[model samples]
Target: MGAGHAHKLYRPAHSPVHALPPHCKIAAVLCFVLAVVATPRTALWAFALYALLLAAVAAAARVPAGFLLKRLLIEVPFVAFAVLMPFVATGPRVHILGLSLSESGLWGAWNILAKGTLGVAASVLLAATTELRGLLLGLQRLRMPPLLVQIASFMIRYGDVIADELRRMRIARLSRGFEARGVRHWGVLAKSAGALFIRSYERGERVHLAMVSRGYTGTLPVPDAAPATGGQWSRAAALPAAALAVCLLGWTL
Candidate 1:
């Protein structure tokens, strides 16, 4: 697979966060997201606290500022949708920038924007702290549906393989003077896609056979790993704890 294709997904690192057991980080992220979701939309102070807590976690992980910013932008589209809800949602009218829009819509926008951004931040922080394989192991340990975890595990394992195949196919087509600009090449493109599917299916079967021949089991096992240090545990708990407290305050008052 091209390096560009794998650039953004989790890669292993030697940072403090990376050294922690994946189960702990996964639990913390799940709790943080739930707490953020439970927080009232109007609780601006609570939201700020949640964001700061996430920032603290990121800092402890030693993720670079730009890398973190770039990853967080993945939620921009969702945020944009949330921002637009205030204008299109149905309710009593309010004027903004000379356009009358719904009062309820405005509140809806704020609700999604705050919640979605915080949720994405929490998720990114978790991903940054753990590699994809570790995250999968964490999910497995969490008592998640084994079938779902299996699907995710396979997808993560083969996603790059499929992507590389697509790239090579593209290159071959381009070399053959095929420019996909209009309907003229549509049939050829469709056939190529079908062929790619068949090839991938065969490859998967082969991989499965190989695994079976090598004493394969249904479940992937985690090795006997050392427990996380005190500092790592503290950092993992810090964000979820602060977010929970703030969320409680938001609902109480």
Candidate 2:
């Protein structure tokens, strides 16, 4: 994992949440989300409790409410899809405010909104507290496939480079008074995209060759570190344990 690959989502902090091993946090978030998804949507109160649990994690992590809420905007497309379910889905209808909505669709929409939002919130909190490099390292520690880790590492490392290239291309276009106002400009935009892809592919090839020349192998070297302590594991398990309790209640009650 490269130190140059810090993402905007990570907020630098000295809190205990930030101090915990990256792998522990990753596992905790994963389990927490699983528990959330397994929860019964009919248990509305359980969803509220789940939100509170995440809120507690955010407070421990020193992540602001605004930060979490803003990143949640990424799920707008999912929300839109969920919203349409009630209108388009066929099932028993319930009238609310002069419109007939499927009862099953309402439940489906609620399920998606609740589970999806909680999952996204959990992920946002993880990303907020963990750097991209740390996340790749954590995945490696968790025994994720080396090839997948390498792909993610390279993507994180070069995503900015690709974006910068696109920016420069846009600047060149703007300098030449190329404005994308209508379908006529789509050709130029498509051509620009194609050129960018070729440049990126060529760059990847050069990077690969350079690595091979320098004793590159299928696996990247991992820095040795002590495994998470029992105490740390217990602490990290707290979130998921609480969520599991709630999920059980959701199913039973």
Could you say which candidate leads in TM-score?
2
Q: What local lDDT does model 2 show for residue 102? A: 96
Q: Give lDDT tens digits, candidate 2, residues 10-129.
A: 999999889889999999999999999888788999999999999999999899999999999999999999999999999899999999999999999999999999999999999999
lDDT of 1 at 63: 72
Report the C-alpha lDDT of model 1 over 1-253, residue by residue, as the tens digit. 3343332546456777777888889988888899988888888888888878777767777877677778778788878787788778997998889988889888888888888877877777777767776787777777787778878877777877888898899999999998899999899889889988998899989988998898878755556567667877787787688888888999998
Query: What's the true lDDT of residue 88 in model 2?
Result: 91
Cα deviation at 6, candidate 1, in Å, is 7.7
lDDT of 1 at 102: 88
Using lDDT as the measure, the top candidate is 2
Model 2 stretches astray by more than 4 angstroms? 1-4
